[model samples]
Target: MRNKKQRIAAMCAVLAKNPNKLYSLNYFQEMFSAAKSSISEDAAVIKQAFEDVGIGRIETVAGAHGGIRYIPSMPQAARVLLLKELTEKMTDTSRILPGGYMYIADLFCTPYYVDGMAQIMAEWFVGARADFIVTVETKGIPLAMSVARILNLPLAIARRESKLTDGSVFSINYLSGSSRRLQTMSLSKRMIREGTRALVIDDFIAGGGTVKAICDMLGEFMIEVVGIAAAIVNRYPQKKRISGYRAIFELEELSETKIEISAC
Candidate 1:
């Protein structure tokens, strides 16, 4: 018999990892070996916790695939609160590096903070009423998945290099921050229907090439792009100010080795 908080945490964990998955109460029944009624109680507690915290959503689907799924949702307060926290952490000077880049990746991966970051970005997508979440290959998948879960939409990744995917969209391009030659790519034309209002997300943004390409690709489908979110924005020689919404702007480079941070 798990205690109140423990039970709620456990159930919430399941839903967080498996958002958009139709979970069965029966699955919870077997996993915890508690009475169905008791599991029901735990679920209700966890569901409301999810909503009250503005982390995401809790939905019931009725039957199979019909348990508790954490769907993405928007509540303004949650986003504001999280951005504040991000700003605070970035205040530490040690987080900065040379060449006007900031080091907040460690904090981003921290189990202590990643969840909060994930929730806020998800809310941004929801607030924009975006149809789905989009990001370039690598580094941004975590944030994308979090928001995708919140929105109950799909998480589509653009590959840096072509994979086994038969129909892929490929663009030869120079990365924004790093002039190093790179490939900006995605799945075939068959994938990614036209006219999706995608919310672009990333771990950080120094140069805007990837974002620009993502916007351009979305254009192919006649999809409207709502906006973009990053865990941190390192304002280097090139300032990145996207339209419609100002970024949370979590971090900045004071010098090659020094950094500064601000919250939303």
Candidate 2:
């Protein structure tokens, strides 16, 4: 039989690996071959450890169907540190492209960066009462998927164009916030149900055109946008087509020879 220390360590592994998932006390009791009282104590210990370390949140749901769930969260200090590091890296002049755009594809593709970004973004919307996550196609999918996993919510993608594989889709035309050119975005009709709440996640927002288009499309399905989040937002244009969105970093300037970014 495993000792108390062994049982607790095993439980921590399970909980940390499956954040936002619930595990009943009875389930733990059987798994650890311990009594309900002992499992309860073990859970309490784990919760305190997580809180003290500021790694995440361990919540105990009350009720017959209740269980324990680990919610991924970052301490304020850690959030600041991560954002600061990212800002420094992004501001490197070499990252600025000819079109006055900063290249961040590598950052989004890296698991370490994406995971940290997702944790921070997930913490912001943990209480948003969102039924699922939404994002436009291409660059935003990776970050969106990570956030959805952390939130334990489904993800719905809006594509730039409809594909036959998508079957019947709901399409709409909206002006690109930055380019001022009309663009069409579509989603599969069966991707989401009506009257549900959605949280939009995107890799970058400029003029908020893409985000606004997504919001307008979701509106067609009667899905309420609970919140919006992005990895970066351009500081130029001063105003965006959409409002109430949060971003991790703000791009203050982007030129061929220099780049300036700051944490938001």
Which lDDT tens digits does candidate 2 get at residues 1-264?
459999999999999888898989988888878999998898889889888989887899999999999997788798888888888888877787777777889999989889899998999998988999999998989999999999889999989989999989998898887878989999999898999999999999999988888888888779999999999988978988999999988888787788888887
lDDT of 1 by residue, 36-64 (tens): 78878887887777778765667776765
In model 2, what is the error at residue 33, expressed in angstroms?
A: 2.1
Question: Which candidate has the highest lDDT of all?
Answer: 2
Q: Candidate 1 local accuracy as lDDT?
A: 0.66
Residue pairs with colliding backbones in model 2 are: 177-209
lDDT to native, each model: 0.66, 0.89
Per-candidate TM-scores read 0.65, 0.96
Which residue runs of candidate 2 sit more than 4 Å off their true CA positions?
none
Q: lDDT score, residue 123, model 1? A: 54
